[model samples]
Target: MSLPSYQKAAVIEGTELVIKKNAFIPSFEKNEVLVKVIAASVNPTDWKHIDYGSGKTQGSVSGCDYAGIIVSMGEEVEAKGDLNLGDHVYGVVHGSSLERRNNGAFAEFVAASPLVLIKAAKPLKTIAKGQENIPSGPVETFEGASTLGVALTTIAITFSYYFKFDFSKKPLEDDFLLIWGGSSSVGQIALQFAKIYGIKVIVVASAKNHHHLKSLGADHLVDYHDADAVEQIKALGKNHIKFGFDTISLPQTNQKVHSAVSENATTNSLLPFNPKDLEDYRSDVDITVTLAYLAWGKNTKVPFPWMETDENGAAVSNPGFPEACKTFFKVASKALNEGSVKHIPITVLPKGLNSLNEAFDLLRHDKISSGKLTVRIEDSA
Candidate 1:
C-alpha cells in the first residue's frame, strides 16, 4: 500500500483545534508503527491539553484514542512478531503532547509505539450512517474500538498495577469497589472489569443512568446529584468499600469518594490531587492517581502540579509500567475476544476531523454523557 506524504489533521491553533488540510504525515521511529487511522474518538484530556496545559503548541495534532490499520512498522516492531502490516489495531497515544508533537490520532496517519498498541481479534466493522449509537457489546465497530484504547489502558493499569489484584484468583464476595462518575467512559468500563473479577461495584452517577450502569454490572448505584450521595455509597457498601476509583476527580468528587471508602481503603483518581487537600477529609485512606500515558513508559508532561517532574519539567519514566501494561493487554485481549468486555457506545460526529470543533464544544460544556464522541477519518474527505 502506498502512503501519502501529507494528510488532513486536527491541529492546535492558539487555544483551539483547527482542521489542517496539509499537515505533514509523521515518520515512525525505530520502535514505532505508522498507522492509517480509520476512526478516532474524543477524550476529555484531548481538550484539556489545550485548555489547561501548556504542552500542546500551535500545529500539534489533537486526539488520543484511535482504531486503524498498521501501514508500516519499524525494524524492532517487525522483529517482535506480535503485530504486522494490515493488522487492525486500537490503542492510546499522547495527542498534542510536548514529547510527540505531530503524532496524534486525529489525523490521516499516526506514528505510534507498538508497546501501547493492541491487535484486534477481528477486523473493525464499519458503522452505517445514522447508526452511531449502536448497542454496546464486545469489540466490533471502529467507533467502539476507538473508545477502548484509553479506557482499557487506564483500567488495566488501575487494576493490575495500582490495586495489585491477582487475576488468577477471584476477589472475595465481600469485596466492594466504588466508582465515581459511573456514566463516564472510564467509569462504565471499570464497572465491567470489576464484575468480571468477581468484585461487587457501587457506582455514583446520575439517576437517569442507573439502569444502564446496572446492566453493566453495578451492584449499587448512587446518584451524585443526591444530597446524600456519599452516605448512600457508605451505607450500600456497609462501610467496607476496600477500593475506589474517582473518574471525575474534581476536588469535591475526590473528597466524596474518599469519605465513602472504609478506613485504610485504597482510592485512585484520574487526575493528581494534593494530599493536603484531602487530609482534612480522610487521612487513613490511601490516595493515588493514574496517568495512562505512563503506560507508554516515556517521560510525560501533564498539566497537574501533583505530577513529579525534573528540572526540565518532564515527568519521570516508570520503567516497570510498560511491561505491566503489556501483560495486562494480553489479559484484556482474551476478555475482549471472549466477549466479556464491552466498549462504550459512541456518537459519530460528521465531517471527520472537521467535526472536532463541535465535539470539543460539546465535551467542554458537558453536553455529552454516557457515550463517546467519534469521527470516521474517511468522512473528512
Candidate 2:
C-alpha cells in the first residue's frame, strides 16, 4: 500500500475546521501508529472546544472517534499483543487538543497511540472470574466500532472509580441505575453496561425513543419532557436505585436527579458542574464528575502507576495511563462483542468533510436527538 505525502484534512480555523486539500499528516512517537481513517464521528467535546476556540494550535483537524486500517506501527508496538500492520482498528482520539492539534480523525490519515486503537470486527475473548477466557461476541461494523470509544471510555471510568465495581464478577441482580438523558449516545452505551452487569435501568428521554431504549435493555423509561418526569423515575426506582448518571448535567437536571435517587445514593455526571451547588438541594447524596480524557492528559496519574508522555508526544516517565486506557478498551471491546452493545443510530451528513459546518449547526441547535451524527470519510469495505 502506498501512502500519500500529504493528505486532505479538515483544518480548524478559529471556530470551524476548513477542509484543506493538502495537509501534512501529523508525526507519531515511539508508541504510536499511522492509520488510514475510514470513518469518524463528531462528538460534543470536539465541538465544545471549537465553540470556545480553545484546545488547539492553528491548523489542527477537528474530530474524534475514528475507525481505520493501520498502515504502519511504532517501534514499541511490535511487542504489543493483537495489533499488527494492516489491521483494521477503531477507537477515540483527542483532536484539536494542544498536543494533537495538527492531527485528528477528520482526515484521510491520522497518527494515534496504539493505546487508543481496538481490533475492529473481532470476537473479544473476555476474562471472567479467575481470568478464564470466554467468547463474548463479535463487533459487526466500523461505524458501530467507531461509536464505542468516547462514550464507553467515559462511562467505564465512571463505573471503575465512582461506582467501584469489580469487572471480574457477575453483576448484582438487585442493583438498579437511573440514566438521565438516556437516548443520548453516552446514555445508550451506559445502559448496555448496566444491563450486562445485571442492573435494572431507568431511563429518561423523549417518549418517541422509548422502544429503542427498551431494546437496549432499559427496564423503565420516563419522558424528560413530562412535567412529572422526576416523579415518574422516583416511582419506578423507589428504594432500589443505587446509582444515578446524568448525561445532561444541567442545574435543573441535577436537581431532578437528586429528587429521584435514594438518600446517600452516588451520582456521576459527565459535566464538570460542582456538587457544592447541589448540597443545598440534596446534601446526603454523593456526587462526582468523570472526564474520559484524564488518562490521556499530561503528568496525570489515577488509573495507572506511572507517567507517560503528555498529549504533545514529549517523553514523560508515565507508564500506567496508556496501560490503564488499554485495559478499559479491552473491557469495552468485550461488552461490544457480547452483542448487547450498539451504537446510537447515525445521521450521515452529505458532502463528506464539507458537511461538517452544517452538521455542527444541527448539533449546536439540538436538531439531533436519539442518535449520533457522523461523516463517512471512506465507504465501507
Candidate 3:
C-alpha cells in the first residue's frame, strides 16, 4: 500500500488546537513503527499540555492514545519479530511533545516506539453505522482499544514495578488495594487488574458509578463527596490496604488516599507531588509518581516544573520502565484475549479530526467523566 505524504491532524498552536489538513506524515525511527491510525482518544494530559505545558511546541500533534495498524516499520522493529506490518495495535505517543514535535497519535498516521505498543489479540471490530458510544466489554472496537494504552502502561508500572505486587502468590483475605478516582480510565482498569490478581479493591468514585464500577471488579465504593470518605475506605479495608493509586493525584486527594491506606503502604500518584507538601500527612508510607511517558524509554522533558530534571531540563530516565511495560503488556494482552479484562467505555465524536477541539474543550473543563472520548480517522475524510 502506498502511504500518503501528508495527513490531517489536530495540531497545537500556542495553547490551542487547530485541525491541519497538510500536516506531514511522520517518519519512523529505527526502533519505531509507522501506524495508520484507525481511532484516537483524548486524555487529560492532552488538554493539560496545551493549557499548562509551557514547553510544548507549536504544530505538534495533540493526542496520546491510539488504536491502529502497523503500516511500516524500521529494520530493527521488523527483525525483532514481536511486531509486524499490518498488526492491529494500540499504544501511546508523547503527544504535543517539545522534543518529538511531529509524532503524535491524533494524526492520520503516527511514528511511535514499539516498546509501549500492545498488539490486539484479535482484529478490530468495526463500530456499527451511527453508533456513537460503545459499552464496556472486551476490546472489540478501535475506540475501545484506543483507551487502554496510557491506562494500561500506568497500571503496569505502578503495580509490577513501583508497588512490586507479587502476582505469583494468592492474595490474602485481608489484602486490599485502594484506588482514588475509580471512574477514571486508569482507575477503572486498575479495578479489573486487581480483581484478576485476587486482591480486594476499594474504589473512590461518585455513588452513581458504583453499579458500573462494581461490575468491573470493585469490591467496595466510597463517594469522594462524602466528608467521611477516607474514614469509610479505612473502615471497609480494615486498615489493611497494602497498595494505593491516586488517579486524581491532586494534593487533597493524595492526602486522603495517604491517610486511608496502611501505615506502611506503597502508594503511587499519576501526577508528581512533593513529599514535603504531605509531610504532615504521614511519614511511613512510600510514595512514588508514575509518568506513563517514561515507558518509551527515552530521555525527555516532562511538562511539570516540579518534577526532577537534569541540567538540560530532561526528566531522569527510568532504565527499567520500558522492560516493565513490555512485561506487563504480555500480562494485559493475555487477560484481554481471554475476556478477563475489559476496556473503558467510550463515546465516539463526530467529524473526526474536526472534533478534537471540542474534545479538548471537554477535557479542559473536566466535562468528561466515567468514560473516554474518541474519534475515528476514516470519518475525518
Candidate 4:
C-alpha cells in the first residue's frame, strides 16, 4: 500500500485538539511495524493530560491503546520475517505521547515497537506457574489484546510486589482482596487478577455497577452510594481483607477505602499511633494498602500512614508509585490471551481519523464511565 502525505488527523491547536483536514501519517522505525489502526482506547491519561495539561502537550493527534493491522514493516521487522501485512495487532501507549516523544500515532499510520507491542503476539503457555508467556499463534483481536496493556499490568504489579505474593506457588485460595472503584478500567483489571491468583475479591462500586463487577469475578460488591458501606463490609466478613487497592483519590472519592478497610483490614493488619489513654499496644496482623500513582511531591496526601508497614517489607512512603507495574503489564497481556482476563468493556467508535478530536472531547469531560472509550483511526481491512 502506498503512503499518503496528508491525512485526516486530530490536531492540538492549543489545549484542544481540533480535527484538521491536512495532517501527517506516522512512519515505522527500522525496529518497528506500521499499523493501520482500527480501534483505539482512552485511559484517564488521555484527558488528564489534554484538559489538565498535567501531561505534556501533543504535537499531533492523541489517543492510545490501539488494535489494528500490520500494513507495513521496517527492515528489522522484514528480516525477522514473521509478522506480515493484514495481521491483527493490539497494544497500549498514548498515541499522544508517541507523537511528542518523536513518533506520533494519532493518525492514519502508527509505527510501533513490534517486539514489545502488547497483544501483537499470541499467548503460547502459562509459564513460571505465576506468569504467562506470549509465543507464536493466531493473535487475539485488538479489543481483547488492547484490554491489558496498562490496566492489567497495574494489577499484576500490585500483586507481585505491593501485596508480596509468592509466584513460586499458586496464590492461596483463602486470600482476600478489596478493590475500590471496581467499575473503572483499572479496578476491573484488579478484579480479574484477583481471580487469577485464586484471591477472593471485594469490590466497591455503585448498585448499578454491582452486576457488572460480579461478571468481572468480584466475590463481594460494596455499594459506595449506600450510607452503611462500612457496616455492610463488616457484615460480609469480620476481618479478612488480605489486600486493598484503590483506583480513586480519597476525600473526593470519599473514604470508601478507609471505611471498607477499617472493616476488613488487610490480613488482620494493625496500625500504630500513640497509645490511646496510655493503654494501647501493637500487634502483628500483617496488612498493607497500595494506591497506584505516586506522591511525587507533598501535594499528594496519603490516607493510611499509621499502618505499620512498608511496600513489600521495604521502607517506602508512597503507595501508588509507577515504574513498579511494567512486569505486571506483561503478566496482564498473557492473562488476556490465556482468557484469564478481559479488557474493561469499550464503546467502539466508527473507524476514521476524522472523528479523533470529537472522541477525545468525550473522554476529556469525564462524560464516559463504566468502560473504556475508543476510536478506530484507520480501516484494518
Name the candidate that leads on lDDT: 3
Once fitted onto the true fold, the runs of candidate 3 whose alpha carbons sit more than 4 angstroms away are none
The sequence of per-residue lDDT tens digits that candidate 3 reaches over residues 279-356 is 466778998889887776666886667476778888876878887787777778888878889988889998888888
Worst 10 residues of 2 by lDDT: 126-135
Q: Estimate each model's TM-score.
A: 0.96, 0.85, 0.96, 0.68
| Tens-digit per-residue lDDT, 61-91, candidate 2 | 8777887788877788766646788778787
Backbone clash pairs for candidate 3 read none
Q: Candidate 2: lDDT of 361?
A: 81
Native-to-model Cα distance after best TM-score fit, residue 9 in candidate 1, in Å? 1.0
Candidate 1, residue 72: Cα displacement in angstroms equals: 0.5
Q: If both were scored by lDDT, which would come out higher, candidate 1 or candidate 2?
A: 1
lDDT of 1 at 121: 83
lDDT for each candidate structure: 0.85, 0.71, 0.86, 0.56
Which RMSD values do the candidates have, in order?
1.5, 7.6, 1.4, 9.5
Return whichever of 3 and 4 wins on TM-score.
3
Pairwise lDDT winner, candidates 2 and 4: 2
RMSD of candidate 2 to the true fold? 7.6
How many Å off is the CA of 37 in candidate 1? 0.4
Better of 1 and 2 by TM-score: 1
lDDT by residue (tens digit), candidate 4, 72-153: 8889888987677777766544445422432344555567664335544552211122222222122254544544444544
Stretches of candidate 1 off by over 4 Å are: 303-306
